[model samples]
Every structure is written in structure tokens, then in C-alpha cells.
Target: MNIWNLNLRHLRALTSIARLGSISAAAEAINLTQPAITQALAKLEIQLGQLLFERHANGMTATPAALLLAPRIERALAHIASQRVTMAQLRALIMLADHGSYATASTATALAQPSLHRAIGDLSVALKRELVDRRGKGIMLTDQGRRIVRTFRLARAELEAGLTELASLQGVETGRITVGAMPLARARLLPSAVSAFYRAYPDVRINIVEGSFQELIEPLRDGELDLMIGALRDPSPGADVLQQPLFADRPVVLGRVGHPLSLTSVTISDLALYPWTVPAPGAPLRVQWEKMFTDADVQLPNVPIECGSVITIRQILLESDFLTLLSPDQVAVELEAGWLTKIADTPEGLRRTIGITTRHGWRPTGMQNAFIQLLGEVAL
Candidate 1:
């Protein structure tokens, strides 16, 4: 087997697709667009000289060829993960050689200058790969260095998890647990638990990336972030994802106080008659909303704007009769401020369980585990 033939991106993309089942699901899992994922898959298929998937009604499923290759791919992935730590060491060496005692920066930086250089040098020599060479620009990664960094990201994450695990066992706290979550959760759910976790483990760092549910899933699945919390939908059943329902969130229809429908005593049919800024199609809430309308013998109107942004929905509400359906958590500010009020006291068929997701068999680091535990503790 031309072991050098398999690159990290190829293996990861394949694994993601095999796990999730569709290119679209894999894209969501890894946070790439459908086009980018398709291209990656195409390239990997070409490199491997075999079709990896069979397109299906729900999504794609791995082919027998893919199944046969799984074990070898996994083994290679494991080796790449080990090589990555070594690669980090080499890159660190190169970085230090160039930056030279960058002690000029504040002491609290995540990676110090000296440690970076030594790590890089050690990695390069250990790999027997001249990842960098001194040139007029001081130093540059050789052709191999570029490839290593390009494809080794996931493996690097594995390396990091291993290192973090070891340090935790030694009772030497590592750093922050990074979480990728939608803006509403960041605002409402994370603050309290994160604050408490920080107080108890002062040395553990905490980081957050805020986006819509669609935006956060890829980061979480790719191991870039520890976990994500949002409306629990089955992870694109085809994308190899594992989800756990953490809490239930009520569905809400929202409008400014002055909106025409704000106090109209609207029935489900009344909702379908109005212009709406709906959540994008395929999302669980949107699907549920459509089903509710369909059940009431109404077709969900043509959505002029379909988005996942509560802020934008709120802005649309302020200017026009355009209305929105949101998770209760999302409209907390506007609701409390009296800018938006409910059309009804209760929204039937609008509530859903919020779920947390991670890679199927993926485990969390100590910090990640701490944050997730805290999130569950402070759930509404």
C-alpha cells in the first residue's frame, strides 16, 4: 500500500461522509459548504481510484469499498495523529528560530516563543522531514511542511486531546475548554455555568464562538470546538454525528407590539396568511412550523426571508408586518424589553428538545467535559 498516498484531508472527509452518509451532512459536520465538501470528496475518490458512496434517498451511504477501507483508514489516522504531535514539535522549532525570544509579548499568551521554536525543530528532525529551510525570508516550510499543516489539522486535534488528557491526569490543568454555540445559548445558557466553572477552576480557560446552529455544528464535529448545543435534530442521519437531548425549548411566534398580528388571536391558519421571515428550510423548527401549518390545512406562505438570525428577525419585525418564529431563548431580550410580544399565550406544536452534539465516538477533554457538565447544570 502506498501509505504516503493517503492524505489527512482525504481520510477525514471520507470518514465524515461515511459517518454522516451524505456530502451535505459531512459538510455540516465539518462546517464546509456543500460545494467544498463535494470537491473534497471528488478529489479523495480520484486519489483512491474508487467510489466511496452510494447516493440514497436520505443521503449517501458508504460503499462496500469504503467499508473495507475503514480499518486501514482508521489505523492511518491514528498514526497521523501521532505524527502530528511530532509535527507540532518541528513547527515550534521553526517558529522560535524566526521569532527569537518573543518575550516582548505579554506572559499570558497561549504559546510562548521559546517553546514554539524548540517544538518545531524537534518535530522536523524526528520526522526526518526538513519541514522548513532557512532562506532570505529567514525560514520557510518545505513542500512537506505545507502538506503537513494542510492535512494534519484533525490529527493535530487528536494530538492535542491526548496531551490534554495526560496533563489532566497529572493534575496539571491545561487551558480553556472551547465551545461553539449559537448566539442565544451563548447569551442565556453559557454565562451562568461558565462563570461558575471559571470560579472553581481558575486556571482552566474558557472560550466561545457564537453563530447560528448551522454555523456551530461543523466546528464541533471537526474537533475544533468541544461541543455544541442547539435544537436537537437528528444529526443529518447520514453525517456520522451523535446527539443527546439536553433540554426542551418552547417555540415562539414573535412580533413588535405594534405589529398587525401582535394581538390578533391568531390561529394556525392566521399564521399562514401573513408574510413571514421564517427559519431556513430543513431546520427542525422550520420543519415543525411547516408541519403545524400543513396540519391546519394551510400552506406555509412563500418565505421572503429565511434565516437563523434572531437579531435580523427582530429587525424585520420592527420595520414591517413580517413576523418570525423563534426559540424562546432567542427572543429573551426583545420580549423582556416589550419590543416584541407573543400572538398567543401558548404555541402548540412549537416546542422542541435542545440537544448537544459531538463526533460519534469522540470524547471530550477535561475542560470540555467541565463546560458540558456545567451547561447541563444550568439548563432552563
Candidate 2:
């Protein structure tokens, strides 16, 4: 179901009724008439197709559906943190923040530009804060606007999760999991887990977005991604993210199968003689590559190409004498095909932890948890 179709005020009324146990008390709490609160509850039940409350002689008793949903609704509202912000305002601002232009946001939402503009203007007035600023041909979100957008995204996630749980209760499994995958995870870990998960929940959709850690972190924080899988950073990426190590991966020096360095034993001095292709600066692989030279007391080698793409690096290695440090898993196919060979292990058996990263307090639905369990099983 499209959660945006439901009224935020009605959702608030539902939570209030669940807490207060009577229509009169709930209406008094949210400043609505008793009849209005009753209508809101009835409308919510009809929309959700579940009996939210059981009428009794003394008061209303919440059904299982309401028990599941009320806390989610309360948490979502806490993220919003504003009694004055309307659903229309939240939708408009989020669209503008995501698309970066009123015209594009209008096209995306199928709303008239004037309506979007009015909604944003009303939102700014209600919140008593500036959300957007005109810059050249477009507008940009203020810092406050970005913070609001993040919270709104999280709120939407909570509601979507609640709906997913409700659907599961009805024996209907539904929801999407967006995963941010770095190179190592893409090569084997993610594919194995996804295949196992699909066999169990065929109807759920899984989306894998491939990028470096720098590229995927923001989306993971903003609730655009369910989780990220890749090399774990040394000093946690931030206070808001949690990392779980699935396994340890040791990198190898890769070269063309017939390259000069393909000997059984290779030295750092031997490695320094060849031109290298490494990931861009700040990448975990690049850091390990640098440390290899430092530990051996050898000057860093000349890196002719700084790249993060395994395919590009593989093609270059096959065509020329460029060596790179990579997890063997990343080049397993090339090794099996005899297109590339591991020249040597990284110095001192340097290893990076491969794992999952997620928002610190994320609460995954049952399907999501099952997928995570599958990842652990596949790792084992």
C-alpha cells in the first residue's frame, strides 16, 4: 500500500486512541472532537482492512493489528517531531529535496508546480525555518532542510515496515530490500545470500546498488538503502552506523597469468619495480597497498591508474604489466579462466574484515532479518 495515501492526523489519532483507551480521551489529547476521532479510527480500519479496535462496555480494546501498528506510528511521529507539519508539506519538501528542482519534483510527483510551491511555502512558515534557497537556475536545501529530509525518510521507512509486518500477519509477504554493495561483496557474498533468500521469499524484491564505501554511506544513513556489505572500515565510519564482521579476507597481488612477477616467490622490491593499478585514495584496498610498501621499507610503487572497478583493472592487467592488490574473491573468475594469477600474498598476510554495515538502530522486518541470517549462513 502507498503509505502517503493515509492521513498523518488519522495515524496520530490511532496512536492516541491506543494509548488513552477511549475516543473522548484521545480526541481531547489531540484536540479533535470525539466524533472526528471515531471517524478517523473507522477510516484507518477500512483503509488497512483490519479491525484495529474492539468496542467494549467501558472502553475500546486494541486488536493485534493496532498493537503492532501503534508503536510504529508513534515512533514515526517522533521522527517528524512536529505537530504543525502536514502530510502534504512532508511530501512536497521530500520531493524537492530529492529532485533538487521544483520543476523536476513536480514532474516526479505529478503535482502542479504551483501546488508544490505553495506546500513548501506553507511548510517553511509552519516550521518557522528556511528550507530552500534560490541558487542560480535551481534551489538547494538548507542544512535544516537536509536534517528534516533525513528524519522524514526514516519516518517513511518505519511506516513501510509496519505495513510490511501487518501484511505478514495476513500471510502476504511483501517489501523491498535495497543493498549497497562494494566490489568484494558483489563478487560472491551478496550473490550467494540473495539466491538463498529468493528461494524462500520469491515475491520480495532485492535491489543491489554497487559503489565504493564513500559513495554508499550517505544513502544507507538516509534510509535509501537497507544495508551495505563490504570491507569494514578501521575506526567505525561514524557513530550512526554499526558494522558486523562476517569474515576476514586476505588480498593478493594480481598480475597477468604470464607476467614477469608470476614466479612462486615474489618480494616487495620486485613488486615496486612494476607499474601498479590501485583503487582511488581513501579506499581500504589502497590503504593496504600503501602499508605493504611501508612495512617492507620500500618506497611506494608508481601507480599509473587509480581505479575502483575490478573489471577495468582486470582488463588492464591482461593487456599490460600492471599489478594490483585485490581480494582473490574479486578476481576468482579471471583466476579460474587463466586470464590472471596471484603473484604473491599481501605482506604479513594483511587481512581486511568483510561484513555488513547498517544504521545504528535499524529494526529489520522478519524478511530482512531472514536475509541477514542467510548472509551469515553463506559466510560460514
Candidate 3:
């Protein structure tokens, strides 16, 4: 079905008819004639390739398709509305959301109360939903209105990014890249690439978000992250994102500079006697740490901390005798600074592919592509 034919008027007709249960009521709600509302519903059904409602003697009964499509239609309408909406209206909405009152929103936006009200009303009309409601002394966003606000924020970010890229094409190079950094990238890889990219394009803004796999994937899929850097997941990471291998890194046991394990030739069993700081259970590094003990017929060590932060883990290693298995790339700077040392060799065949994760079909802008190329240079 060609979605372009299904306009806001058609969507409004569908939602109103489903909610009010009659064409006449739907017409009155949207300020359209009964026949116009009826025609809109017919056109919507044709474009969607499904029946939305069944007509009865008394009124229209919503079909399963109608129920399924209502919320989606609302979201789609909101997204479309966000594009057509003016900056003043969006600014008014944001201020209204923050202040929770039309008077305060007007104060913040430096617009008159009626102007602020009109802006919000225009946006509400575009989205076909009431955005805010008055309570005792404050205003609140409706559930659908919250969704619109969230989507509009994302839209604003994308628009800003696009404008930044447009400026970059003229050789100005002022832009922002939001990177989702997994444990490995936070250590050395991202820092090195960021430094190099900054040297070349100092005007570019780089924001790194640190997270575990579970925490970062959704943001990557939602266009919130330009790309994710860290270990590649086996099998495909669903069909929404593409994983590109940049390098392979093996786990290395690390400790304080003069720790007991660093002085002696150590076996996995010999190292298992001490307290350890390992990755959280089910992490790629944690899985490899367990397998190391299994191969050597050793019991797992007492894990005082199952940490995911390389920064925190490095601090722990610096302050204590606890040992941990991690990718060497995660501690290159600390190792170079002589604060930590590699205590034991990783088990043979214990290696993970570190790579980049980006949404499928995502196209990088000029500066984004340049930063990605810089990552390739810094990666092993």
C-alpha cells in the first residue's frame, strides 16, 4: 500500500470513527461533513489494504485491523506533524512540557499566553490529539502527547545533525557524533580514535555513551547513536544493525604493578586462589574467564566485583591485589603508565572480535565517515 495517500485527515477520520462509533460523530469531532468522513475512511481502508471497521445498522464496529492500526496511525501522524511543525511551536511545546503551565511556558518562550496557547493548539491539530490538559493548577501531557514530544525531540536532533553535515560540506567541519561505547571501546580504542579525529577536525563534537550490550542496542537502532564500538556478537545482532569487524582482541589477566601473580610464572589454577574482579556473568570476557578455569581443572576465584566499567575496574586494579581478565585494548594506557601489569596469558583460542555496530542502511555524513576511517586506523 502507498502510505502517502493516507493523509492526516484520513487517519483522523479512522481514529475518530473507531472512538466515537459513528461517521456523524467523527465528522462533528473533526469539523468535516458526514460524507467527507465516510469517504476518508473508505480511502484509508483502500490504502491500507485492510478493513478498519464494519458498518452495522446502529454504527460502525471497529475491526481487529482498526485496533491494531490506531496507535501506529497516531504515531505516524505525530512523526509527520513534527516535520511540518515550526520551530516556535516546538519550542513552545518543550517549554510547556517543562513548566507544566501555559503562563510559565509563555514566560520562558517570551511569547504571549495566547500565542503559546495557539502554538500548542496548532501542533495538537496537526497531530490530531490533545497534547496537554489542565489540572488543578498545572498542565500535563496526554499519553499520546508524550509520544509526540519524544518523537519530536528525536526529529530535532536529526534536523540539527543534518544542518551540521550541510555545514561540513562547505569545509567548516562543525558537527556532532554520538557514539555508543561498549566496555572495550571505552578503554583505549575510542579514546585514541577520538583524539585523532579531534586533531583533524577540532570543531566536531563527540559524545560517548558507555553501556553494556543490553543497554546500548536499542539506542543504536533508534538513530540516537551514530554507531556502537566494541565486541561483535555471534550470529547476527538481529536484522536492524550491521556489525563490521575492526579487530580481534584476546583477554589478558591484569593486576597491580607489583602484585604476587605478576612476579611468578602462573597457571590458571595458581591464579584462582586470589580474589578476582571479573566481568559480569554472561559477558564475553566472563565466559572466557570461566573457560580458562575449566581448562586448567581449577575452581573459579572469589569475584569481589563483576564490573563493566573499564574506568572503575582500572581504579580497582590500581588500589587492590584483585586480578581480572579483560581485553588488552581496555588497559593500554594504564599498562603504558606502569599502574597495572599483565599477570597471566589468556587461554589459547580465547579471543573476541571487536567491531563497529550501526543500524542497517544507515548512511554516514562526511565527518562521521571521516571519524569511522580514523577508528580503522587506531584499531588492531
Rank the candidate models, highest TM-score first: 2, 3, 1
Error of 1 at 306 (Å): 1.6
Task: State how far residue 140 of model 1 sits from its true place (Å).
Answer: 17
As a TM-score, model 1 comes out at 0.62
Misplaced by over 4 Å in model 3 are 1-154, 235-237, 295-298
What is residue 122's positional error in candidate 1, in angstroms?
15
| lDDT string, candidate 3, 1-380, tens digits | 22323455777678788889999898898799998988888877776566789999999998876765665455544554643566556667766776778887777767899988898899888767888887777778998776666565544444455445435544578868999999888877899999999999898889999899889987776556889998888777799789999988888899999998888899877798888888788777787888888877888889978887888888998888889888776787889999999998887788888999997766676788999999999985
List, residue by residue over 217-314, the lDDT tens digit for candidate 1. Answer: 76665456777776777445435577777787777777778877774668777777778887778877788678777776777776898877777788
Model 1 scores what on Cα lDDT? 0.66
Error in Å for residue 299 of model 2: 1.7
Give the alpha carbon lDDT tens digit for every residue of 218-289 in model 2: 999988899999999998989999999999989999999899989657889999999999988788888899
What is candidate 3's CA lDDT for residue 265?
Answer: 94
Question: How many clashes show up per model?
Answer: 18, 0, 0
Q: Could you arrange the candidates by lDDT from highest to lowest?
A: 2, 3, 1
Q: Give the TM-score (vs. native) of candidate 3.
A: 0.64
User: What TM-score fits each model?
Assistant: 0.62, 0.97, 0.64
